[model samples]
Target chain A: MSNLIKLNGHTASVAEDEWLLVSLPASEAEERKQAGKVVLFKLTGENTVTNKQIANTVIPTTGKVIVPLSVFIARKAVLQARISKGEIGVWLSTHEVLEHLIKSQPDLNGLPMMAIHVERFADGRIFSLGTLLRTRYGYQNELRAFGDVLRDQLYFLKRSGFTSFQIRADRSAEDALASLNDFSVPYQGAVDEPQPVFQRYNRAV
Target chain B: MYKYDEIDQTIVDERVAQYRDQTRRFLAGELTEDEFRPLRLQNGLYIQRYAPMLRIAVPYGMLSSKQLHKLGDIASKYDKGYGHFSTRQNLQLNWPTVEDSPDILAELATVEMHAIQTSGNCIRNITTDQFAGVAPDEIIDPRAIAEILRQWSTFHPEFALLPRKFKIAVSGTKHDRAVVQAHDIGMEFYTDAQGKMAIRVWVGGGLGRTPILGSVIREHLEWQHALTYCEAIIRVYNLHGRRDNIYKARVKILVKALGIDEFKKQVEAEWAHLKGAPNTITETELTRVSQHFETMPYETLPRHDAGFDTTLVSNPAFAAWVKRCVHPHKMAGYRAVTLSLKPHGKAPGDASSKQMWAVADLAEQYSFAELRVSHEQNLILADVKLADLFALWEKARANGLATPNIGLLTDIICCPGGDFCSLANAKSIPIAEAIQMQFDNLDYLHDIGDIEINISGCMNGCGHHSVGHIGILGVDKDSSEWYQVSIGGKQGNDASLGTVIGPSFAAEEMPRVIQKLIDVYIAERMPEEHFIDTVRRLGIAPFKANVYTKEGAAA
Candidate 1:
């Protein structure tokens, strides 16, 4: 089980096996794991990290570390090149991962990716980031973001880009599972690809 | 006096609504301070030392009397009843709360004005000679070109986000009073033999950490291609200019980094792609903009004023006022009178509500209801007749506007330094006041003659300290305020940057330092040489030695 803490308002989660990690894309996580440095990132609780910790330079680029968002804006080219080569590991925030691909694609050919929801707080930028990444940038990967992610945001986030989530350890898995049935239809284009909104209906038929 | 057409009106109204929304979001906490910082800056709102300062663009230093009255009303209602005219030909209100800005902007919009792109990392208000259309030597009104750029660049999709702020100045007069050499892009308006006016464009001149004079890139570009050329330059700069270091982000640095030739080539390539496109200006649009000023009725009268003679004979003070405050007009009977806001010891460009009303009244009564704010920190009634000179001077003197120090040593161009500005190193207003008190003697100043003592609070050069005949820059050393003095900088016609004289001086010691330099000029000058001409003749070595010498041999 992971513990979550709100940091700079973004819900951040920490796992016992991890030294310190903010859920980022494959590239960011790869960079961190490769760096293998003891990382300290801001979070709402003991386990979760927010988008604010996306590019923070708490420790030098020794090995696994969390970076700040500003770092990505500055070193997009270099970071993109590294990500393309698959030499680094990254944890993508719910939405940030998609913007990167849409804005800059160093290796769009076939790159494995994953997403994380930092917290269950009131802030929704990460969810928007997720939806935009999936719907706008067309990222089809394991999307997980649900701390306090209400059924609506979860459904939207799922339809948009996210596909997987870590629910509250205390809550019943059945109740949590039951809330996921709030939405009837996937509206239109999503993280998967540019397909018709009624493609799910087509699948059902 | 470029009137707003449908497009111009549309852009301004759209900008006002945009700023209103930004303000609402900022007030409602929907936008964070970091997110709203650039948005407010794009609307020309600065959180200054005391309060929020709103800088309203007075495009090319031109304002209609109605516009001036609107500024006065905004200052009175929303602010502390006064406005400071900035060196950029803009008006700044220093005491407005965050909430009041939306209303103030909305008010400004009614007059076809909004503070868009004035303080942001985008193209700033395109400034031209204050005497643009009225100046005798102008080929055509540079305001024509300025208005074209105004329309084309306002909320320009691509240029809205640039690496750094860009400033373009145009000079139509032979004498470059517009400080063309110190702008990011300086264009001189000239006519070819076939009588078609064109722009002689120079790029990459600025004064901040690294002061540079622009090198000419395009000698003769047609007026229609002016906006496109400017867009090309800005686009190239936006993509290539450095963002890592704030100091290196200005286009001047980019020009320096790339070298002028390569920069010009890049700009030429960019220009090639952009020119003759959909954005090319139309002659009909130019005609529409030019119509705003084309039809001012002029009554041909004799050159001399008999009343001016009688007043000169009767009042020596009036004659002295004429000598200093008045200038020869392009029209025979008319004279351009400067309403000096810099009294014996006051802030350089500040005018109270009363003073503003007085100038408005005088403009209406004497000068065709038009006024000009000169780059020299004074207001000009550009078309006043010589016959009404005495009445105007008397009215101005009564209102404390007739300082009789136009272009003299005391007519110092100063910026609001540490007292108000957030980016100042030390207080510049006090420094100017101190110098003004030291040089109170009119005859002494007249003897010194035609000297520009410009002071900047910091290195931003808002005070135009670089081009002053005697420039003073405020620097802090060990917590004490000190000034760096420079000699021999001139702006008009032949522009040269001033050379610093050795070490800096304590704030109190600056006046003596200036006196010493003047003493050297007085001793070395041939018959009737001014400070700058003497510096030209004798070189800076003598002035440097005399200024920095242990003993001036006389004190």
Candidate 2:
């Protein structure tokens, strides 16, 4: 198993990942074998075609699978029975709004896992999205921030409310894990520490 | 003069260590140029025409004598023997090697100074009125709030990689000396109905290729919401600012595209969640930051120093210099002095190492050991006593700092254009020098008084030409250096952009073209009216007709 995974503030092997991502780039998926459960990202490329396919996709209930919200909403009846059994998880791209999923499935907040894709390391849309998922939507499960996850961005991602980071296949998890403590001190309120340094100064006094 | 506490000092020190490692990895080929570009830029290192230019942040333009001495030391040791003060109230060293920049930052850290966020897409140094505390028409001092912003924007996690660079300026008082509307997020401080400090927020105003004035979104936001409101704005900007085109990436374009109302709605929506969150300003921290800017050890002096007045009367040059360079201080018997950087032949704002050290010594001796770098690129001694003004003038003249033409046409605000900048389409320093030479007659310049001639290398607007009374923009025409002239721009409560006269002019004709414009102004201007006022009264039509003769700019 590949040892390029960082979960719960510790470096881990790929075997420890609960769900294998289905629609990762060929290079990333080929580098590691999937854990038995997989998050199917079938509608992944060429936006219009993928989106249309998602609209007409047949939800596969073969074993356990995490569904993209787009796929889940279009084919909710196919896996509606499985969600209560704690079998269905929801996945979202950082840019995808979660309000629709919450509207479609009231129990979406109680799902065991939610994964968000970061399109690029430099793109910070996921930071706000992850915060909203946790704070606004009350998502209290495995919050995964995957894709383009790298060393320099680890601390910010962790503070921005991602519980696990799937290191981009070519990067080392050991190096990325060390960056989580890049800043031990705080200045402003963030997802992980809501009390800015000013409040901390108050409590200290 | 907000001194860095232990926490502040530690963070800057750690940043120095972090940047040093990043630089090491880039040099070792572990990182590509693209990967290292943003990294170095966040630390204020830019690749310029000849070598690496490291921009050092002077937060709110406040500098102590010790800090100025350290800057002089760094300029001498790391680069050449000179440094350039930019229009943003920061210092730019134009010749440091990439390998030597880490050491320069490390040394800067010793003086509670760093180049962090000076040039990156992140929020830059927070600027305010250089005369914030000492100006005669002052409200509350903005140092505390500016310091708060300086800390909050430093090493911010989410906004670090925004689509374009962001600038924030706090206009401390009723007078818009900070040029509020020319910044990305400009704020003005005022007292509320409840006697609490409040701020007026202006989003999306900037001076790049597309110069646009800002609109007020929140006219009565309490000062406590400065952080939360700013956070909301940046968050909204971060998520939606267009990254497709580099030029359309500034918040100004975003605000323009969304329309000010819609943009304000989005920011307000985002702020609803962050409004009273833990990031809101508190009185405890305010008190802490305020103490650093508390009244200095000022001695009570007589209303007038008779000896100084006698000296001022006896020396006509001293009298003229006092009239121009000396500004009234809110503190009795004290004055604020501007040491002009726009002398006749020198590149405006370029100070040699010796000049830097001499100014630092003057700051130590005359101005409460504090100096300010104005956005106009001049150094300020903000707390000199009137009794000492004559002695200070003598020393300043000896050091080549007292030019006695503060508001005159010769006092030009110019960028290090084609001479030092790679992005410049044409040379701006030579244009400035030629104009200064042509207008070398101080008597004539004073007669035509209070003109702002701002020159920029290109549309990046580093020299803030868009708001100058007379704006000169360097443009490339058929691979040759040409200049475009504009008039009627002004920076005050009624700030407005300039209008281009006609066509572009060749380099050699710049001085003569400026001379012709001045001649028209002299012939037609109302008595004692400023150039901007005259331009506003007569409009650009007359100036255009007079400037573009058959053999002049039209040629």
Candidate 3:
């Protein structure tokens, strides 16, 4: 059975009955996950023993395991373990990491998932990166935005193809949600609304 | 002159209500100052050094008698009984309280005016020739297109939070009286070989810390594609323009960084998606807007008025005023008169409430109840009959609007510097006043002939010092005010940025330095040559030597 598990204040669905094994902090994984939610393992460093453990614990079914890109790149055996189990998802902090992954793992084109970390001041850069990633690299997974999300900037953030935002805990979620509808009309193209206002108006006319 | 219909009226009315609510929330502590600053600025309210300065947009500088009277009334009621006409052809009330801005805006809306997109990062008030429809050299009336652009840019959701402020100017005449080259986007209208009206579009031109003339991105764009093309350009800018640095965020910087060719290619790529869109203006809509700017009901008269000729010969003062202030009109007996605001020892553009009322009365009595605010911070009665020159001059003189120094040394273009603006490095009005005092003689000014002295308090170039024939910019050195002089700049058809001469001068020494520069021009000027031509021929070398010489500096 699949169940929702919280990791570092973010919620993700995990398949425990399947062969998914998440590589994150063990304490956070244990406290946030229900019994038999998923396999939780700590990635202290890149070693053959951890990879062997990961390889032995896998069950053959379609599932996803979330792990940082550093651990995935360090241990090729661990990557093979995740690949043999099901799909592999990686958390990214910068464009450098994404570039390195693309160059290193060409066969993981349709197999790998991407989640981008965004800063408040780096919206323009992240937006541009998201555009190139989708249009040029054929990245189809739902892109996630993390870190210091403000309500006023949600409209622009969402327009840039970020499907999920890890909003700050102190902020009001309702206010942030309402901000998505603050502007009834937009003047340019975006992921949520691809047609510019002029095109829509012309079609109506 | 485009009358507001129900839709237009609703747009402005809703904006006013929205701003009023914003003000309420701000006062109740629901919004922080940081949150409320951009909202207020978008509505044309700026918290200045002394008080909140509210800028009221006078679209294309056109005004009716009733609107003029309403402005005067607002000046008396909400301001300090006066208003300053800005170089952008808008009016600024320098003493309004921030809380009172909503009330003032509501009052403005009653007269079919609203202060939308005046001061924020979005598109600003569209400007054009003061004598737009009536200029003799006009090939196509630009006001209609300007009005269309105004409507399209207002309350634009995506562009509201652009990287920086944007400005657009249009010119209908070949002479470039609208200073198109100094705007972010400059559109010049012309008839192509097919007898169809087309536009030449220039992008990335602006005056600020870095002054660059706009480069032509589209040499010939059909009139139908005007709005859509503009949308493409702005969208490209909004998505890709630099946001990390405020100083490097203007479209000019982006255009320069990308090169005009690459920028044009990018704009073309973006425009490919927007071509033939609904925003493309139709002939019916064009006619609907153009009809509002049709020629006034001008009475037919003889080409040569005997009384006008006689008045020129009989009254010296009237002739001088006519010579300096009157501009040619397309009609035979009609003339456009510039009412100079740069009288001796006064702020360049300040007009008292009584003077505003007097101009309104004059407009109602003559000139078909119309007035214009020129980009040089002067008022224009654009359709005055030639026969009424003497009477209009007398009334204008009485109202302190007739300085007879139009296009002369004393007719300065100055920004309200440290006195009002919080961003100013030094005071500018006193510099203008000192120079005006030194050259107060009208005959001497007329002899100097067409010397433009533009002054700005800072490098923001609000006074357009970059294009002044003799530009003066204020600089701060260790917290003390100093002035720098630049020579040989000109605005108009062949716009050029001025070249700054050597080191800075003290405030008290500016008048002396300017006098020395004028002396150099007098000594070297050929017969019938204007000040700008003389400076252009001689270059800044002679003037620099003359000003820096010990004897010249002491004088």
Candidate 4:
């Protein structure tokens, strides 16, 4: 039971007291195998890995099994049971994975900080993702957005629930800081204020 | 006329300040162009072909004399000393600079107006009958509800970035003067069994590349649930509407794809969560909004006026103008007069700065300081005294606002086509001009009687060609502009899209095509039949055969 278990041409082992991260590769699954006490999996592209295959390979052991957030959300019930049993963790790469997970699982709270890449800000997904993570899912972990973050979008990002932002190399933090107060009044619900403008009006009046 | 309360005033002022800051940031290079485009559009500033066009909202088509003067001042100061009243009942300044937009908005705010939500993928300016409160057939005034919707949708957060623009039209009568069936959301106000006002809701009606008449989703919805029901409909469209194709993004496509019953089911399911929400209108709030549009005080007088009767017979032009332009008002001793903006040789709905000032003065003198912009691209003095018809006609005639061709063949509704619009496929104004010149004889026009000749530069249908009795759409064929003629479309209560007559014709041949259609009408019409009636009586066969004939084609 303590030795490496080989199933369907994939190899993985359970550590005694540490978490394991697994990386599922298409053709070189044997070459990229980690022999460390903690193993985490980074599944990329269309692979043949199923929820049952990952579960069978990782379960019946004591160590923590970390998987990609997208796979975790897709197999939430099976992974959530493992997470509650202190045998699983999630690794996230994009905001969409977190948004879907939080929206589908309301009881999910306190996600571990994950690397967030902000590729486009004009589509308003960055703001909405942050809003859903904080307001709807009760996410308490630090949320970060990186890549081409402008000073103007910072105002919306912070209000929507971003704790930290990786500004571009050329932009200054002071310029970004000044934009947080761009609009004194916002018309929507956000992490900091959960009431819409109309409800706020009713309360004030 | 709904006056702005303190809250409304504060909201407009705050929006001005907010936009001023946004403009400053963009000018200083802090905000990128992509990030600033939607914000600027929400403020009604569009980067057109030649210059920036700023559209100002005229809520439910109502304007005060003071507001009109403010518009005139802005037009003269910032634009090319003129403005165009659009078919959506808004005003567009065709030649304003982007930098001066904030100042223009500030000027508008002073007169209880702003450019909020005039353009963008948001709920646009709410439209209603130009004769909302004064029409004899009206059950209740729709302006109160239109005003409420205006406030409710302003800067609505969830609906700000919809897949496409949304439009709402309210009608208080069965006549459908506001073209309610052609809007994104059409509300028909009526009295229920308990004598309380209720609304019949219609959804997904729009005219774009696809022309669809809306279907009734709810037969009788209580009046208080208007806002919440609208919210449910919008949220469903915003979240599920197509974002892949720009042309297929309107709610009409969504409704069509899901089918009306399934769409209504989804909307009702969503409404289940928002029905009793705080946004629901209360009696107090209803009364508060309704008080703003209460009937004005009028002097006690007989229904008939001898002075009005004498003026009608004394001058033939005045008699013709009264017959065509004057509309019956619900109130005794009062009438609604449409000041025609469709004078010959001029672009329809384009008002010069001097004409704006003149109309403002006329409204102040004869219509209790109120005026309206009709969806027909004309202006209305809704509360004019019957005895003041002759005096008002003289003033309107001198200012080029009296064409006496309302509801007639030459009262054309045309879009600012390839000349100013970047999206036009061909030129529409010149086509309208040619047709008006060809039918310049008022006697000939009056003999033809009550024909709506709507022209659009493209299939966007800004001129509402789909509902025009004689619809002319400009198409680009082989890089040359060609006109496609359609006939027999009727608007009012029996709204129907026009049928294309035949193959396309050259721009120079539009007048001949229209003449041939009118000649067919004259030849085939029954006694006392209108143009549309004749076209409906005999199908498009006669007209199509006559227009494509060798002699008709060579004319």
Candidate 5:
């Protein structure tokens, strides 16, 4: 679990994150897909690893787990039983192909959690990706923005359909929480405020 | 002027508070310089070579008398007693402290002005023709739409951190006075086949290290789709514009790399989802905005005033001012007049607080209490009555605002280059001054007829050197300052980048080299042919040959 997560605009210590995200074993996943074999990824009660950097994966009999969307799609049969109970969540990186993911199988709509990765602080691709997922595709779940995220961007991150923020290490979660209300009014249309200023009030008057 | 309503007021007021806190954190050492740089830049505060330079937004060049007065107060109170009007329609205070910026922005908010999103990678101030509303040839008043664009771009969250700065210019008339062809996005208003107003959009135009004219992407887009379609374009660029190289980060590079056709395809695909969505412009909103730009109170006057005719015949200076400075208006009795910031021997666009106050008074007395900051680095009284021309001319002369060199060579557009900006390769202001001193003769300047001389400090083209008929670029030659001259660059509907003539010149030699170029045009030009027309008739070869002759080249 991460140190802190600002969930629903309330900053709290991350005592536990229901499911831990597991990165795909790239070469093995590709090889197993080529061989038409299912690869089961295990969620271990890890040590000596940051919550996001867990590496051990085989089958240690799973607890709740979140895998990359591709990993879950390849092993759908094994993951299907847990997904119905909202135990297996799917995660996607900002680097993933958006056009492919929007129309991906295993429907992101039913997931209990979908986390979008901000690989770099300046990479704004995830903002649009987050917007489309909530506004166009109508993804309604715990939408978390993690990895390389900071306090300065949390205000708009919340506006762009992000419900929870995993502020990057050692910085303030309370400060990030306060930054959410920096602007009491925003001019544009976003997930949080679907009605733009024009529709909300006769501004030009 | 578009006055701020409650929402507009709240946004700026909130912006002030937010910036105040950010400044406090920064000064307390909570925020590092790297982290605080972009935040400060977004508020139009740049840490220049000498001090913090704050650029105050003068939305599309329109300013009321009250706003002008407030700016004067701000200049004198927070900075040195002077400010410079930029090539883009904004004012730059060159001597403000980083600590005093918050108080400056707060003062601006009182006058319904703000510095939000004026700099940094976000969308910059939307510029149009300075004579937007009053131009006789205008098909539409671009201000209303420019205002809409301003609000849409201001504080836009997703776009606040773009790969590079983006600028947009709108032209409502056939003439491209706004220099639309040199911006990131240029829009022209026209009527479509359906008899509704539409926009002709140009993409990939910019003038930094690469000076490229915009290519037309969409020929006929309904005006209602402007904002949403713009969102689609910027969003695509935001996601796909190359971030690896700082030089290649502008939307122009992305548009060029993708090709206009491929880029248009992507933008159209994105716009399909956003078109007619919540961000679409509404008729009610447009109408409400348009009301703010409606015609000012004008009395019924004849096409020609007899008394004004007498004054013109007697006072040749006033007539010369009218010929070069006064512009035709849509209204019968009104004419738009240009107040030359380029007085004969002064720094091109520098105006003291005294001049600002004087202009504000003139704007109230003779021009309906409104003034416009022309992109050519001058002021405009857009609604001066014909009968008041003589009185206004006399007063403007007294205030150092009346120089009859509007379209002539002396009216140079220059950047605050090495003198102030951190990125400038060499000083630009001295080069402009040297040229101004050489051509100090008003008789020779007016005799030469309409020509534009634009100078840039570096390759940034902040002074729009690329589009000037005679462009001057300050370049560094082994830690020494040298200048490169180009010929035939033009702005307007037929905008073209100038071609560099030959080798660079020493600082003092710039004026003499320019003289050589002008001598060639004078010798070769046909009767009444302007410098640009002469250049087009003959190419850069003739001008290059004139400057690089044996003894001339040695000098």
Candidate 6:
């Protein structure tokens, strides 16, 4: 069945059956039926829930630990030693690191989810980030981006990840939906999902 | 001088218009300060310690008398009647108003000059040996290659967004007067075993927080692949160079993180993709560029002018100048005359507007309407006729450019440190003045012959302190000013960074330290040896011991 995709308030194809809508909050995850809340499950900066949070409370051992981009090998080793052995998720800021991660971990797709942050929509670093996910890392799961997201950037984001985005309240649902028709062809490639432009051209022969 | 053709003229004119629009937007408040900062800097406009400084490009340190006159006119009209010649071979007018910059650039463009990339984190003005075409020992005229690279890299789309500013220097002679070792990329043309010109490329060499001698990655790259190879290296560097930390953003850090061999392999991989692209150098383009610098028809005269000899013999001061300022030339009659700006107690490499006008007139009268700014903080008339030597010397003496102190103790290569540059840690001009005052005699300077006393306000090496024979570095010690002295360094082909003698000296103790070092050199020299040659033979131990001895300590 088709689902209602409310991205920054406008409705488009939810693609819930074909593409997953990965999010971060537990409450947001409960509200949506098909969408999954893959909260950054790792300790970062001064904030973020740690292993101690789950140690005192009763959480499932099947959960994954989502690590920050700046997390190092030493912290990873400590985190693995402290928590029970489970699937690990790594969130990165740039495509170069994503390439390194994919090269190091050949079976990264088997993990539940991997998310990347586009810190600011004004910054073009996300273009490289998206390019890496699709071209280099070949990540199949939801490539979520937060912070300063807008409707205009969503088109490129969709081509790269085929996932949903979180945008600011000032951007209306009408403008967000209008931007989806800005380009017909995929400017970039996505993993496990061939863009309509690419598929039509390739199968025409 | 290389005259601008239709394409060059169009680009410059379009750039001028673009800058005028940017300036208008900035003045009208459409662009905020944060947004306008990089825009202004990219146009060679700097909000300086006092006022906005306009830096104009002196492409490859080559300028015609007409260009110098135009620069003087710009300085006089828009600035405070002066321009400073920078170590990177550009000229900066320190007091130009923000409104006057577009007019200044328009004025410069009239003479086929533009300030593009003079201050931005882009490919800066390409520099080469001042004696590129005139040096007797030069194997090829590096100006041809310098101009080619300058044209290719100007406004290049792919490599423009580098992590940091990139500097490239070309040297035809093995002597390396261009200081190619201290640049981001250094290219030198050398004849291979087959007697064909091959380019030797050096990468990751820069003098800053970490001064590194670039490693030679490609020994005998064909001349046709110069641009493509350089573009490949920059492409790989731009895409991979670290940008998280500004300090760790240079290609040096990348080369350090990945070994030079690995960097070379990556560059080769990139070059393999770009080998036949539009960026590749074509023989037609090379010849077109080379035609601009082909040697002018020179009239050969006597090797030595009897008039110059008579004047030298008659006037002791003129004799001293002739002995120091004149250099041997490969041409039968031409001689390279060095106009030392390092007067007894003046700023190094600073020619006031008046001095600039004087040099322009002298170049027109004596030389072939050409002048060169050497990396050694001196101006050179590269093609002076032998017959005009005496007349030029007399006129130069009147304007104070004929300081007969070339290569002497007073010939100091200094940078405008804390006084001008915001990044400088210590004031360097006063230190240079102090040393110049202490050693004012031509006779004494002649005694302390051929010693390079380079001073920099900081470790950035703008003054080339690392390559000085007697290098002086200003350091802050316990909130007080101090200088660190180094010995046995050399700049040319035998380039080596100076080794520090010992602990740093107080600012007051520097002159005494220099005296003691010179004393050691005089006492230990093995007959007729130059300062660098003697230092190499006796090593820095004897000089270091003398300079830092407890008994030789300052009272």
Worst 10 residues of 3 chain B by lDDT: B154-163
DockQ per candidate: 0.03, 0.25, 0.06, 0.07, 0.29, 0.04
Question: Which CAPRI quality tier does the interface of model 5 achieve?
Answer: acceptable
Better of 2 and 6 by lDDT: 2
lDDT of 1 at B202: 86
Q: Give the Å error, residue B453, model 5.
A: 1.0
Instruction: Identify the runs in model 6 with alpha carbons over 4 angstroms from their true place.
Output: A1-205, B550-555
For model 2, the docking class works out as acceptable
Q: What does chain B score (TM) in every candidate?
A: 0.97, 0.99, 0.99, 0.98, 0.99, 0.96
Candidate 6 differs from the real structure by a C-alpha RMSD in angstroms, to one decimal, of 10.3
lDDT tens digits, residue span B1-555, model 3: 788766566667777877887798789886678767777888899989999899999988888888889999999999889999999999999999988999999999998998887897778999999989999899999999998788777765446567789999999897999999899999999999999999999999999889889999999999988888997898778766766567777999989988999999989987886787667877766777788888999999778899999989998999899889999999999999999999999999999988899999999887888899999999999999999988988999999999898889988999889999998999999999999999988889888998899999999999999999999999999999999999888888888899999999999999999999999989999999988898788788999999999963554
For B74-102, candidate 4 gives per-residue lDDT tens digits of 99999889999999999999999878989
TM-score of each: 0.75, 0.93, 0.81, 0.84, 0.93, 0.77
Clashes of each: 55, 0, 0, 6, 0, 0
Per-residue lDDT of model 6, residues B202-304, tens digit only: 8898876676778888888888778778877886676677655557668888898889999999899868865755545566666666877878668867777
Question: lDDT for every model?
Answer: 0.71, 0.83, 0.78, 0.79, 0.84, 0.71
lDDT tens digits by residue: candidate 2, B238-304: 8778665668789999899889999999899989988898889898888888888988788898879
Residue B358's lDDT within candidate 5 is: 94
lDDT of 3 at B478: 97
Cα lDDT tens digits for candidate 1, B1-555:
666545456657666766676677678875568657877887899999989899988877887777888888888999888899888888889899888898898899888788877897777998877776667776677776686676555554345446678899988887887888888999888887778888889899987767788889999999888876886787667656654456767889989988999999989987886686545666765665676767357679897778778879989888878889888767788888889978978999998877887788899899888788877878888888788888899899999999889988889999999999988888899888888988899888888888889999888888988888899998888987788888788886678898887788887777778888889988988788888899888878888887777863754
True contacts kept of 4: 0.02
Can you tell me the CAPRI class of model 1? incorrect
- List ranges where model 2 is wrong by over 4 Å: A1-15, A24-51, A55-67, A85-89, A105-108, A202-205, B551-555
- Which CAPRI tier for candidate 4? incorrect
Per-candidate Cα RMSD to the true structure, in Å, reads 11.9, 5.2, 8.9, 9.2, 5.8, 10.3
Q: Please give, for residues B74-160, the per-residue lDDT of candidate 5 as tens digits.
A: 999998999999988899999999999999999999999999878888899999998888888898788999998998888776676
Candidate 4, B214: how far from true, in Å? 0.9
Model 1 chain A poorest ten-residue lDDT run: A38-47
Q: Rank the candidates by lDDT, best first.
A: 5, 2, 4, 3, 6, 1
User: Could you give candidate 4's per-residue lDDT for residues A48-124 as a string of tens digits?
Assistant: 34554544443334555655555666666766656666565554433234435556555554334433455444334
